[model samples]
Every structure is written in C-alpha cells, then in structure tokens.
Target chain A: MPFPQFLFPNSKFPSQVRNIFLFIRRYFNLLLFLFLQGFSIYLIVHNSRYHNAIFGSITNQLTGKVNEQFSRVEYYFQLKKTNDSLVKANAKLYNKLKADFELPDTTSNIFVDSLKVDSIETYRKYNYYPAKVVYNSVAAQNNYLVLSRGTAQQVRSGMGVIDPNGSVVGVVTDVSKDFAVVMSLLHKDSHIEGMLLKATRKQAHSAGMAWRPISLTFPGYRKVRKWLWETASYQVATVPAYQKV
Target chain B: MNTLVKNIVRFALFILVQVYVLDKIHLHQMVTPYIYFLFILWMPFRMKRTWQMLVAFALGFTLDSFHHNPGFHAAACVLIAYIRPFLVNLLIPQEGADTNYEEPSFKSMGGFLPYFIFTGVLTLIHHGWLFLLEAWQFGNIWYFIFKTLLSTAVSLVLIVVTELLFARKQSFRTNTA
Candidate 1:
C-alpha cells in the first residue's frame, strides 16, 4: 500500500527503492554538481569537432560583436599612437617613391630612361589589404590577433598579415563572417624566413650601399632590423673617413 | 529584489572586465590574472547550492566563449562553486551568528586575514585546475605549477584590492538585512 510498493507492485525491492529515493533526496545537490561537471568535461573532450560546429559558431558571433564594440571605445584611446604609426609609415613610403630620388648626380654617371611606365603593372607581386585589429595580445604563450575583416572582406586563412610599416605581424588562421583570428608572429609556432644583412668591411665603408644577404630563420624578429641597423651604423662610424672613397 | 538587481549588475560588470579589460592586459606569460572567479567566490552564502553551481557554470561558459576554449572556464567555475560552501564552513565558524552577512567579503568574513585565506585558497584551487586542464599534460609539470602559482598570486592580489575598493561596508549589509 506504500508509494514504493504501489509503484513496483511486482517487485520485491521496495526497501531498495525507498533507500534510493532517500539517497537522491539527501544528495540532490551533489548529483546536480556531478551532472554539470560531467557536461563540461564532455564539452572539453569533444570541443574540437562537435562543439565547434554547433555552439562555437554562435558564441564566436556573439563574442566577436561584443569585442568589436569594445574595440571602438579602445580605438579612441589609441588614436594618437595609431596616427603616429600611420604618419611614420607614410613618410617611409614617401621616401621610397620614384619622385623622391632625382637623377642621382648625372654629371658623375650616365643614366638611361628606357623603361616604359605601362610595363610597371607586370612587376606587381603582392597585394595589400588593410584590416583593423579588433583584438590583440602579446603576453600569452600562443598569442592571437583578431581583425575586423573576415570572409565577407575576402580575408581567409593562410593569408599573411603586416603592420602599417610593412613589418610582418602574423598569419590569418581562422575567419568568421565578419572577423578573423591571426596567429601572431609572437606565437610559439610561428616561424618566418628572413634575410640578415651583414655589412662587410667593403660594403660598410661605401656610404649608402651596405646590403649583403645572409639567410636566417626569424622567430619574433620585430627588433632584428633596428638592432642590425644600429650595429651597421656603429661599424660605419668607426671606420676611418679615408676609407670612404 | 534589490540584491537580485545588484547581482545581475555584478555579473555584467565581471564579464565585461574579464573579457575586455583583464584579458587584454599582457602582464606576463605566467602571471595572467583571472579575477572573474571572484564572482563565484563572492556569491551570497545563503544562495541555494544548485543555483550557485548554475550561476558559476553560466559565468564560466560565457568566459570560455570569449576565450575560444569551450569548457575550461566552465569546469573550473563549477569546481570552485561546489567546494565554496565547504571552504566557507571550514573557515567561518560563527556562520549562524553572522546570518546578516549577505556574501563573503572582507567585512563579512570577520577581518582581513580570514578573508584573504578564504579567497586565496579558492583562487589557488581555481587556478590550479584551470591551468592543469589548459596544459592537459604532465610533460611540463614544473612549468604548469609555476604558472598556476604566479597567476594565483596575481589574481588573489586583484581580488583583495577589489574587495578593499568596491566592497560595500558592513553597515550597508545590516541595513539591507
């Protein structure tokens, strides 16, 4: 006539049923805690494929939107820095322009202008696309940078990223609808090929002509150019003025 | 109702700070402070155990979404949530006398020492679990331990400073109760 007996009329384990009910009631919180923990572990173990396909996209979209909004506020604070970098980049580009270099001392050397302007189009090798960095980090072991450009802007994985001053930043690893994640050069796994210019005695002595190539692997090479330039300048300064023919 | 509103606002603020601000600060490779776990540490003591775990899970999941790691934060959050009651009960002997204390804080947990120990232990445990899971290997046990300790120290300092700066006074708690 008891509830457990009535529910299990054909069974002889009514006491076991009652005990099970008591156990569930006594440890309901533990049961719920275990369930939540188990679910989270399941998510972690299956995160690469199953979770990414279903929940990852949705959360990515939400987080991307929120990060984009937050980055707008951050962008204001970084306006001066960004502008400074841009101006420096502009000056560097202007210095490289053909107009910047006049007929270099025509009296000392004969110069011939035989190249056609229309033929310059065939020499283009690389295309540049500018994207705003919505999020970036340099402190983590595996650093990543998020850009505002994505598939909609033709940003895809395997594309190399560069800063305004033509320095290598990273490579795009993942792209969503409106955002892309770049694996920064600072990342542990990022290896880039770079040429080390060794200024030999002969080259260093010659003013404005010190470029000798030595191949090297550049991992986090942001300061290599500056450091090498400084050393080369020091070498040049130490050389006697009589060496400058 | 007021407490509920306050908690909701706290949730939003914690998430924003964790994702937008703390996550951006590149202090060091080994000293990434994760004070968001403080949300679980500061939840109302009288809250139902189930609700506490649920809220912790939600907080962790939201952080994981931003971090691009599906369940690391969620697992750590739930573990801390489950152990919090036991930790509080173990530390605070006179819980019945201080029923007016809405949540764990510098003022509620008696004084500075007990509060620091309480939050410090929780932060250590949370960081250990989270970092271990992130490493997912015993190959570099020393590196993992160093990272856990460094991060725990930073997070504990941030937690204590936040409590000192923004934690409501005990007088406010008495009035609310």
Candidate 2:
C-alpha cells in the first residue's frame, strides 16, 4: 500500500512493528551504514593504530587544559604540599644539575644528571613538550584529548601522554601550530602496551573504555591472558622513529 | 547569520563542546557523554540525501580527527544519515501531501513518537556498533549489550529533554508539545 510495504515483503512483525520495519527496510543502506559505522567505532575502540588513532593529540591537549584549569583550584588547596615538594625537588636537583651537566671539566659521567631532566627532549631517548589540555572528550566511543602545544611546541603525533598518577592516558594523534590532540586510555578507540607491576610483569595491549574500571582487555587469553588480567598500574610510552617522521 | 554560516557555526560549536566540555567527564572509570553523535541527530530537515550522507561521514571524520580513530565514527554516522530519509518518509506518510516541505518537524511528522522512534532506532544502531567494535574478540557479551542499552537510553533521554525544552518553532496538530 505504501513505499515501506513495497520494500518489506518478507519481514514478520505485527502491523505496528511491520510499519517501522518496512520503513527501515526501505532505507536498508542507511541501516547498513549505521551498523558498519558502529562496528568501525568498535574497531577503533578496541584496535591499535599509532598513525590513525581517533583520540590522540586533540584529546591530550583538551584533558591537559582541563586538568590545568582544575589544578588552579586544586593548587590552592595543595599549595603547601606542592610548594614543599617543589622546594625539596629544587634543593635536591639544583646542586645536582650544576654538578651533572655544568661540570667545568667533563668527567666520565656515563649517566646524565637527573637535575636537567625537566624536559622530555633534554634526554636523547625521548622527545617531550609542555602542553595545556584544551579539549577532552572521553564520553564517546572514540574519545579525544587536545593539547595547547603543537608543531610550535615540537609536540608531534604519536607521543605518549600519561597522568602524574602513572596511569596511561593516550598518545598524540595530531598537532597544529599551537594545539595538539591525544587519545585517552579510556577512549573506545584506545590501546596501549601495558605491563602489570606484579612479579610476572605481564604485558598486553590495554584496550577498553575509560569509563569501565574492569573494561581493559588483554589479548591471547588462550593460555594465561586471563591470569594476567588481575591488576596493574599502566603507563603509556612513545613509539619512536615513527612519530618523528 | 545566514543559513550557511549558521550551520557551519553549529557544527564547529558542537565539536568544540563535545571535546572541551563533555569529554572531561569520568564517571565510574569509563567516559559518559559520547555526544558527538548528537550532531547527526540535530541536523535540520530538508537537506539532500547525498549531502546528508556526506555530512554524516564528515561528522564522524571530524570526531575521529579529534581522537585518532579513523573510519569508525565516519562509518557509523554515514549509516545513520543514509537511513534518515527512510525513517522520515515512513513517519510522515507522504501520499501526495507536502513533499516539498523543508523539514521533519513535529507538525509534518504528526507527532514526537515517530521522531522519537526514528531517532531512537538510529541511536541504538550507532551505540550498538560502537560497543561491539570496542569489544573486538569479546570478554562479556552482556557488558557490551548493557553498554549499548544504557548509552542509548541516555542519548534518547537527552534528545527528548532537549526537544521539550526548545519549544521548536513548528507546532503541528499531530506533534507533541
């Protein structure tokens, strides 16, 4: 009688449900598109891809900014403790920095002094940049974190971001001149190599929502992936050689 | 602003809001807002089918750009856009009635139920895909199912509340207040 009925000749729903089904049938491609999109979102959420993660750089910038703003109020309360830590750190590193790198005569110093370790790039092994979180969206299937630092700040895509708590946040995905976005560990499109802090020191690609505490998944549970799932504080590390290019 | 400027601003604003405001929420350990899909839901009526699909793809892509996950959101949004025409035609009963009308507003569609159904089904479809893709090999099917249902519920509720609060300009006899 109508376009929908013309499209749905085989569905078995009551008249009311059939009407809806018929309509959906008429637009089957959209449904397929939607389904595939959902599936793709799930893939992004669970799979791993450094060059194409959905929530990498922007998410980092965003969360970094929010945390910074929040820290303002937080700093007010934790000022004493923060200052105390700063003084202790300053006192400890001030002499060490001068002695380590600023040494008048270069001795056989195998290790660089930890005092000059403030910037990530200062170390040859890792590149680092200071950034502010400008935007962060973790509530979606593909959550993103944005940062205020970009090419100007030498913040490249694929660098790992972490909270002070040692928990893995995500990696840098994109960077503009003054802004960068990161994918958070809690994002549906998130995955990272994480090692359990236990004696076994198990490692797996941590994937799951930042929402669900028990959401993280480890692959190859065929033998002992299940056993290694118990508990661990995770960290995000940069994949070198790839991001620099 | 003209319609073009208005729509552009709307798109950018939503993206900004989604990333800056909604993404910061950490409820129980998992993120909650996931409202980037709202862009697809809130689009104006009368847009072309092909354009709508393109917009859906673009919406997902933009969101994907915000994160590092590509193709996933783009795919989901495009699907929803493709299906939108079918949903509207079924709900509106276009039997030589106002075919050229510019929107799927409540007045043209007869009521909120049709609109709700249209939006709700698409929402479910989108969330379901998102959850399953994230699941990959699967640990607990129930958890994924629960996430789909719960997230759908929240998104639908928000849509309903927003419609009610806005008192949109179109008030047809068939539409709900």
Candidate 3:
C-alpha cells in the first residue's frame, strides 16, 4: 500500500523541513483537536457555581456593552415599535400615579350629597427606581442581573426589582456606588417568598426560605447596626452625597 | 471584496441573532436554537481545519461570553470542526470532491438531502456535546437526551431555513473554472 502524498505533495524543501512538515501533517488534526477539547473540558470542570457567578458577571458586562451598542443601531429601525411600547408604558405609569392622588368618581357623588368621608391611608410601599440593566444572563445554572443604579441612586441591597410588566425580577444582592447585582429568581440558590395568586399558597422555586436573624429584637437590631457601622465604615461612608449633606 | 464583506456581515448577524434572539427563545422551556454555528458550517470547504477550529473557538468563546456559559460551546464547536472534514470526505461524492465546492448549500452540494443531513448531523453532535457539558452533574439522563435532541432539531430547522432564505444560488458547473 502506497503512503498518501497529499501530506507533502511538494518535496522541494530540505529533508529536515520536509520531515517536520510531514510529521505535522500526520498529527496536526489529532493534536489540535485534543488540545482544544482538553481546554474546553477544563473550562467545563472549573465552572462551579462560584466561578459561574464570577464568569457570568464578567461576560454579562462585556455582552451588555456590545448589546448596548447593537441596540443603539437597532433602535433606529424599530423606532415606531419602540415609541408604541414607550407610550403604553407611559400610559400605565400615568394611570398608577393618577390613582395615588385622585379620588374615585363614586366618591365625588357621595361628596355632593352628604359629608361622607373615609380615612383609609392608601400609600405606596415600594418606590420604583428605574435602572438600566447593564448585564443580564439567563442561560446559566445560576443567573444574575447587573443594573446601573446602585447605592449612589438610593438603591439598597434589599430592594425588589421588577420587569416592565410588573413581574417579579429579583432582589438586589450586592451594590457598589454605581452598580448593583441582582440574584435573579432563575438562580439555583434563589428562594423568594412567592404566593401563587389563585392558589394563595407559598411556592418554592428552590428550598424554602430559612430566616436567619441578623437582628432579632430591638436591642439586637441596635447592636447589629453598631457592628455594621464599625465594620463597614468604608461602605457606609460611600453613601450618596445628598444623604450625607 | 464581496466575500469579505459578506462574511463580516454574517459574523455580526450570527452573533447578534444567537446572543440576543435565539438564546432567549426557550421553546417549551427546553430548546435554545444556536444558529450562530451556521457561520462555521457555511465556511469555505477548502479552508484549513486548523483555521476552522480556531475560528470555531472564537465563535464559541464569543457566544460563551454572551450566554455566560463558559467553555461548553467552545468545546463542542471545536469537536465539530475537527469532525467536519472527515464527515465531508465521507459525504461528498468523488466527482464533487474533485470539483471545488465553495459553500455548503443545497444548490452547491447538488441537492437538498446531503446538505440537510450534513447540517442536521453536525447540529446534533454540537448540541449533544454542549448539553452534556452543561448538564454534567444532573441526574436526569432522559431530560439531557431530550434537550439535546430538541435543541438539535430546532437548530437544524433554523439553519436550513436561514440557508434557504439567504444563501445565493450557485451553479457548480459554471464555478468549475
């Protein structure tokens, strides 16, 4: 059986050079294939939950930057669609703000007749802080979202983040001066207090929430604050400038 | 000039479509169609395997960066790129192999069947390896297989449709020169 000549069709070069070329030609595919496969396996093996979170954030930042640029370009094409959605969102926001200030039409009729007054104090529990999502990853075992608003914008680590349609997104986990990390509900370790609307019962996406008391009674709460201020002075000091003033 | 511009546009389009669009489409909460690998699939046949693998790695890494899944895509893509030449040798007819086939499309490959089979098999391999790495520690064997198959099917359909819709018709006889 004749050896294949395609590996070294031209033999004009020196013997050593030709031999090296022949050797590379013979084992190039296997060598490179194994090396890449091994590298990939290494990546897979090292991708623990911790690494996943860290890597996820890094990629999220990079992709977010690219997506932002792409979105800017795409924004021009979908101006009409975007305008419609913005109008709808604005309408919804208007309705919500209106409901907070104005009395019902039925209440006006009652006011015209006899003096019928009610003292129900209807107040908003949560203030919506609109933040741009700089990075969001949904395809990992543990998902996270990075938002532009952080401690500088009065965004705390415990704030509940929501989607445009008012679906629960996640709670803020970590916050820097200018950015915050949200542990999305899609994460493996994410366990939130969710009640099914129709069933009116708690549902666990993961394990049930275990309440670990960082502060229990009033006295303990004071102690916790004192400890936090002492230990986390650097973080506390970086509070929004307005708050300090 | 045309080829360079076309590939450049395709690279951007695939990355955008995959990361922004297809990656988000969790069909029935299982399928994530990766049409970006079509970039690698549609590469010139005469391109070296080494270069192909390198391009494949870049493609996978870029995607991994976006999807937040580390090396899974890269590994699977490299494996497919490695096997691509062998698969081509096995599938490409003797006469067709002698004749230069620039792109792997239905018209260029002489018919739809070979192209479909090639794309489908490779897509299955790529998805299977990727999902395996992703679900490495999971207990459900059936679910892994299900996800791989469903994803492969979806990717295959999307790739074929994209090729049919976008690929230019090439006459192999005229291009023989």
Candidate 4:
C-alpha cells in the first residue's frame, strides 16, 4: 500500500518515475492539508452576508431532519417525566372545572353563553401556536432550538415559544417556510425582563446553561438570590415576571 | 474490534456528542469546550495520513453542518490531523519511528503527563485555530487570545476527565510498520 496502483501504474517503467511517486506519497499529507485549508479559507472568505441567509436556511433544513430524528429517540427517555407533567396538568384542569361547577347557578340550571351579542369584535394580542421541538440544545454558549412548525404555519422571528408545561423556552430567531430556529434562554446573549415574585425589585439576568445559576447583570446588584433548578431536558426555568398565560 | 470499525464508531459517537451535548454547554462567554476533537487525537497511532485526513474532514464537516459555519471546523480539524504525525514523532521518539502504537490513552502513553500534554497541546492548537477563524473579523487580539486560552483550558479539563473515567486499560502491543 505504499502507492496506489492508479498513481504508480507501470512501476517497472523506470526508476525515476518510481522515485517521483515515492516522493509524492511521502509529502502527500502536506499537499492534502494545503489543498483542504485553501478550500476552507475560500468558503469562509466567500460567505458574504447575502449568502449567509441562503446558507443558513440550507443548513437548517439539513440539520432539522437529522436533529428531528435524534429528538425522537431522546423523547423516549423523557416520556415518564413528560407523562408525569401531563397528568399533573390534567388534574389541575379537572379541579378548575369542578370549582366552576360548584358555583351556584344564579339565573338557571341550564348553562347559557354569558357574553352579550354585541356588534363589536374582540382580538387577541398574542396567539400561541403550539409547535413541537424538533431539536434543542443546552450546552452551547449560544443555544438554539428548531421547531417543527415554521412560517408556513405562522411561525416567525420574534414569536414566543414555550414548552408543553409553559416555560420560557426562547424566542423565534430565524424562520424558513417550513422550519424555525429559536434562540433559547440558555444562550449567552439571551436576556429577558423579570421581577421577583415576592419583591418589587426589578432586575435583568443573562441566561446560563441549564442547572447553572443565571447571572444577574442589571441594577448592579450582586446579592439577589439566583435560582438553580434541577432542570430537565425539555423544560428549564420560566421567569415568573415574564410568565404570561 | 478491528481498527477500521472502531474508528468509524468513535467518529460517529464523537460527532453526536459534540452536536447534541457539548455544543449546548455554554460554561462562560469565553469558553466553549469542543470535546469532539478527541476523536482525531485518540485515533490509532499507526493509521495512514490519507485516512486520518479524510476522517478528520468528515468529522469537521458534520460538526460544521450542525454549527452552521461552513468549513470552519473542517479546516481546523484538517490542520490538526496534518500535524498529528509530527507531534507523535517529536513527543514519543522513544517509541521509534516504526512502532505502531495502539490508541493514545494514559496507560498506552506510559503515564498521565505525556498523555495529558499530548491531548492538551493538540487541543490548544485546534481551539486556537478554530477561535481565530471564528473571530477573524473581530480584530481584537486580546479577545481572541482570551477565548482560545479559556476554551482550551475547558476542553483540556473535559478530555482529561473523560479519559480517566472511561478509558480502560489494555495490554500494550507494538508492531513494526
């Protein structure tokens, strides 16, 4: 295996030819490294902002497929925890229904729609379109999530995303027609406005990786109680101040 | 397992862990541990350059696809793979030029310090090139140095810890190529 047959065909031809072949084989590593490094540099230098948009989408499409497969396998491992949360949520909903029925009917025994039939219409400021997480990460300095739904289904950048249990997962950062990327709370650049539930003090904290203490950056306060939860794979902590709905 | 099959499996496992696990860990603003490079570092010492470079490219490209930075990781990987043989020669001259050493672990490398230095220096080089290329436009010399050093430290610690916890002792074998 000193030299492949294709490179050293007719080794019997001449001594000089064999010598050249041997030399090439000896230094082949250097040649290959230079060629590869040049190509890599070309890719880095030629990738303009205009091309990044196109490239980014292409990468997302490719990674989305593979990551979706991985997430499926990971989903099995978390089924018990997910199931537990679902059961708890169902019980809460059941209790709420029971409490509502317990209220005495002031008008009649039959249930009646209570809203006045007015000419005016109502609109919702925020619409939650549930999407499954196709991919998620908690280890990177800048973590991102890939959602199964995308712009085709009304998912867009700046839209809020939450887990099944209603935690502040992240906000949609990029959107393709059929896939979307979310900059998760674990990202270093991620900053969400929050206020302590028990106190009136407002502060801003930069998000850290899961299970790590999130750092408080605003108001220059160093003594704030940093919450560290034994976070799960799919659900991390939700900022109480920013918890809407 | 045969060397070929073992390397293939290692390549896949390293890529998977890098993309899904290590990539998610943001220990600090400056440090991002790239443990996947361990795949290249730990490859059988006797493997040919062509195969090593090819495998390195594939590993880096896979990571590049996940990281969404085309060719960055691949370039760094190729660079390190290119220099690996030279580093082996310089560091382990006692093995002689012809010895086909097994996978580089603490036991195989004779002791902890050689293995540590080998893994650490290679990791530093890889991380240095990676961060430099990534922060090419930043033009802040201090920032680049800080990031490279910090990331190298984190990666070194993780690699050392992983080797200690998972590496199994194997009887040393030597063959002449």
Best by lDDT: 1
Model 1 residue B97 CA deviation in Å: 4.4
Off by over 4 Å in 2: A1-47, A53-129, A136-144, A155-245, B1-5, B28-31, B34-38, B42-45, B93-101, B137-140, B171-177
Q: Per-prediction DockQ scores?
A: 0.44, 0.22, 0.33, 0.31
lDDT of 2 by residue, A1-245 (tens): 13445555655556897767767757755665666566556555454544333454454445355455654554576678767865865675565564566545332242333667563323444444445554555445456666667777777777777544334567776665566667666554455554333333455444332223234453433324233233223333323233322
Q: After aligning candidate 3 to the native by TM-score, how far in Å is the CA of A154 from where it should be? A: 10
TM-scores of the candidates are 0.71, 0.60, 0.63, 0.61
- Where's the lowest-lDDT run of ten residues in candidate 3 chain B? B167-176
Clashes of 4: 7
Estimate how well candidate 3 is docked, as a DockQ score.
0.33
Question: Which lDDT tens digits does candidate 3 get at residues A1-245?
Answer: 13366655665678888888777768887888899999878876776343355555556556656766655665587789768867877887777564676566343332142323543434333456788776676655557776776677887666777665555566676665566667766665454453323233455222233111211333555654454333232221111111110
Q: With candidate 4 superimposed using the best TM-score fit, by how many Å does residue A169's alpha carbon deviate from the native?
A: 11
TM-score per model (chain B): 0.92, 0.81, 0.90, 0.91
Q: fnat, candidate 4?
A: 0.51
Ranking by TM-score: 1, 3, 4, 2
Instruction: Provide the lowest-lDDT 10-residue window in model 1 chain A.
Output: A236-245
lDDT of 4 at A26: 82
Docking class of 1: acceptable
Q: How does the DockQ of candidate 4 come out? A: 0.31
Number of clashes in every candidate structure?
0, 62, 0, 7
Highest DockQ scorer: 1
Give the runs in model 3 whose Cα sits over 4 Å from its true position: A1-25, A51-60, A69-130, A134-142, A149-182, A189-245, B95-99, B171-177
